[model samples]
Target chain A: MKEKRLISRRRAIFTGLTSAGALLLSGCLKKAPPTYGSILRLGDDLTYLAQRGLLSQRALVMEYQQTDITSFPVTDIGDPANPASTKAYSKEYEALLKTDFKDWALTIEGAVAKPGKYTLDQLQKLGERTQITRHSCEEGWSAIAEWTGVPLAALLKDAGVLASARYVSFYGFDKYAESIDMLDALHPQTILAHRMNGESIPARNGAPLRLRVETQVGYKSVKYVQRIVVAEQFVDPAQDIQAGWSWYNGI
Target chain B: MSASQTTHSETFRHKGWVKSAHFVITFAFLALLVSGYVILMSHPRLYWGKAGNDLTPALFELPISKNYHHGGWAKAIPFKNLKGSQVSAARTFDIFNENGWGRSTHFLAAWFLIITGLLYLLAGIFSGHFRRDLAPGRGEFSLKMLWRDLVAHFRKQSSAPGKYGLLQKVTYLSVIFFLFPVVILTGFAMSPAIAANYPFLLIIFFGHQSARTIHFFAAVLLLLFLLVHVVMVIRTGFKRNLWAITFGK
Candidate 1:
């Protein structure tokens, strides 16, 4: 009788465990995206949450030797011939470009004690850093490039970004816009790059200035940056989000 | 014999945990394969170096073409433009687009497969299931027996009941221990965050793109394994095999 009771108990436990496993798996399989048009975006959400919670805020991306630098691919969104190209070269950008970007200045504003525009020469006078790092693109390519620029943290500190600022948004001359969390904004490697491969950044490569966000995907590093906005909350760039890109593309 | 008597006849069955794992793995593998294929369709070309794109040379290119009408080889592969007439243009079979859903579901299924695989491995090892059932015994490892097994398959003669043949055992062991692990590791090596943190993975796998190529081939090998597995199951008593796996009868 005891043996029989024990066998039945074991069966009960097995059945319970199996049901639990099934339930967990079924939860993931639920609401299968119908016709691929009704795709779930929750996967992106889960990844963002997990990475944000688990990964170290201060962790640095790997850097390489100067010899490791390779020919970085130029994704000229402004080029009409490129697939899914964008006309980022607005009229304002054209006017700025016509003069070799001599009149161009990057404006810092919002949630700051001091808000003003700083010229390329003024920005260059600030502390700078040089590093060789791989830029991994979402389109399945990567290249190492040496960048020299003013550390964004030093610039932000000088501008006196308020304690209330939670996000730092970037506006580019190409009309490409993006924003980053405070943690990313303050990361040591984050910078406003002016030089590529020990020379002035070329016009095609976002000349005068570009943002180098070491930890994020290449697209997050907005090129030809014109403005920076500090905010208390994140403002999603809806156009890019609708184009089917994860808002947080650290991967 | 009566139907009732035949239904009650003695049959070989694996343990409960083994049966459950098999059932779950079948679904997970299928999900992974479908989603993986969908994601691959978006970027069909494979490259060897760290960088590649439309302009860069590719190691291998799929029989696919692109246009504005369809996102990929889906709907129809673009043949040529005929005087700006959509209908006049000829297009072959291609079912591209849905990259959004493809990427999302691919990652989801990948996570599911990884979790299920880990649980299955732990359970299998702890319960002595793999050693008892999967590991080949003394005589089973010999080349002569292996040739005999291969010959028997070609001769259309089914092996003895209630036992895995040498080829089946070896294939399963290698896939479980080597192929799946390599696929998972290579997949991680392709991730920017992971790759940036561990550049050594790039060195080990040659480059990021090479890791991606390795992942693709490993998945293809798994597909081959699945094809052979399904064939063997059908050839050897299909109903009996299904019953054993499902009910452990």
Candidate 2:
């Protein structure tokens, strides 16, 4: 009788393990974003799903007082005017730089009813929102800076994002590109920041325009944004998955 | 011997749940250690306060260097120092270049450890396993007994065939109640969304960098515990201990 009970318990454990294996296999069978190594794939999925499920769509990250702003380190400077590194420099960006970015306009296109270019003056006309938020980097550092920009939601509303729109992609003058989900794109704190600490953003700090994805790690907030593209899906031929950075790094 | 009279010398007395939990935690801890070490090697430094980077001064630094080849020791790569007072050398190891894999494995194993630990705790509590087997008995509470146990452990005196000593009980309890929670909480404090959503976590750890520092030390403590645990198992009786843990025979 004891042996029978033990066998039954073992069978129960086996059944449970088999079902879990089946569930994990099913997830891998789907057309999901490229996952990490086999050992980590399941946990990655769990974390992504849990964060999305737990947090409200409009949940705001903690905002701090202006006085709390600290020394935000300047990084990733792209000098388009420098002829020494022509590969990194864009002629169009150099021209705009000569004119103090007056001629620079951010072209918003893809999955939108009204696709057009909007100047810094035009974006400012949409109204500005200043926020003192911490920029948390994936490399393990954080700093507080007050950002002044137009709420991305207002721009999306004006452009009339179509029902098919799901992800928002940003192209930068420095040949850098990144994308964020529509959920983050429509976030109240998500904006196209033009000024930092009450002044026009310096060259080292994405002079013309930049993105502030408050909900994500600092790399998600691409600087020197030249164009905005709304897409139905995330297509990263650029090897974000192959490199080890998760596409949905909400934390 | 009567069937009702429990034999203290029986090595296989532990239930199936204890055996299962032990195996799970062992594998999970091994996986965590390997992947965590790889991740640490990527940025072999610790810091304090809210922020740290290549620019900021590090609190501590490890001597490990990155290498592109598969050769050991001799093939290590060196850092290229930049001509700035504010910056540290751009140093990296390229042997695995799998920080993505390392991070993924680390988190996966962490979840496994957490789930198994919770199950063990719950089962231990409800089934009286903790009280019966782990909690120090009346005789063990005496100062003489406690001192004897410590001396025995240090002197390599073999314990009774199956039962744990007072020192073992206290160490096990500390690992379960204190070290485990510290590592988990510090890991959570490093997450940006979680930290930002609950700013109090930042205050509690003093800052994210401080949390990372604590996490590193706690992991080291865990490693030390694991080393002593394995040594004790071997010392008591390698074959018996191994068989008891694996098959509960």
Candidate 3:
């Protein structure tokens, strides 16, 4: 009797699998084509924005100064190091170090024709320009950070961007993985930022290297980037291969 | 068949982890609620998108006949009038900012939930949570299952209990996919670097301000769902249903 009861219970569990709802929702087994695509697909719009456009993009990033170095809003995703997450006032500028970022290099490689690295000096050697760009974030707040970095085009030009280089994506060490497209990559305000608040980029704030893509939003400005790969196509292993992030995240 | 059935200790199940994750999320959520309430006491019934009030207390005699800093509430706690810089206002903001840490704690607990939920989801899938709805001996579909569940639910009968119903599956799947992702994305949409890095995300709901409004709304929805979920669990024979979730191996 116990065994029979268990078997009946088991049968009851998947009771929905055969329901009209599942049959209707699961598009895999149907012969008739879907009248509408999955609503899941629209969720990819932000991913799409992060992936395309150029030339038409604008120069809207802002700039900040040392004296104007006020409080950057405290992030809710507390640093893994300090889980207690003391308020901004209790925040310490612990990663403070003074170094001329002259030797730093921004490497734009992967799926590119001329995969090469450019030093801050070499990048400046290519041609230098600075802009006060607005930093828009998905977080719904905006701040102006004065950034001094090399032009993205200078690096793109050096890479000779292989014919297939479709997406100029960002690489960061923020423990976050985000990217952008060629349009914003080559935007005038878009830069490989080396300085913030008139000083070298601090480690906590994507130091050693960070991109200042001012037009679209902040997440596109990959920080703590050890390298940038100009892919023949925008390929996010974390997105397509892993848990999907929208291919384009332009807002 | 009897021998195939594994003993309790032998099989890895949610016996331990689910309980732990539940406790952590609950604890962190509680902390956030408490901190937020105290801080909001500084500014009762705050508004979104529009300008709102931030009331301060004035020092005076006991019974504390209070005055609204800007507006009034039907029945709000009043404090006596006071003199001097209102240190409590600053303290309130401090705690409000501090509550942001509760979000971090929630995420940490979320990490635990994702790990455990992953196991449950995977095991449920591979172990045929999807297939259990099908009859074991059949190559053909059964309309009987549907008729029975519909009848039972309509008549408010509890005899049809097995694991989860069709509606349960729908709700669970929606929560797992749509609702949860909305919460996560909206949460990220509030970061400065993130906002700067991905302004397009801000553009999705028109701007960051709107995204935040949506995030708050989603939280309220999740809270409502949680309340309903608890009630349903109790309605569906709390201990028996819980035994499956907690100790079923």
Candidate 2 lDDT over A130-224, as tens digits, reads 99787876545566677899999999988999998988888888777788778889989999999876677766567779999988877778888
Q: Rank the candidates by lDDT, best first.
A: 2, 1, 3
Task: Fill in the DockQ of model 2.
Answer: 0.19
How many clashes in each structure?
A: 6, 1, 53
Judged by DockQ cut-offs, the docking class of candidate 2 is incorrect
- Model 1 residue B26 distance off true place after TM-score fit, in angstroms: 3.6
Q: If both were scored by DockQ, which would come out higher, candidate 1 or candidate 3?
A: 1
Q: Is candidate 1 or candidate 2 better by lDDT?
A: 2
Task: Provide the TM-score for each candidate, comma-separated.
Answer: 0.77, 0.80, 0.40
lDDT of 1 at A105: 92
How accurate locally is residue A216 in candidate 1, as Cα lDDT from 0 to 100?
A: 79
Q: iRMS for all predictions? A: 10.9, 6.8, 12.1
TM-score of chain A of each: 0.79, 0.83, 0.63
The per-residue C-alpha lDDT of model 3 at residue B10 equals 28
Looking at model 2 chain A, report the run of 10 residues with the lowest lDDT sum. A71-80
**What DockQ values do the models have?**
0.16, 0.19, 0.03
Give the chain B TM-score achieved by candidate 1.
0.80
Best candidate according to DockQ: 2
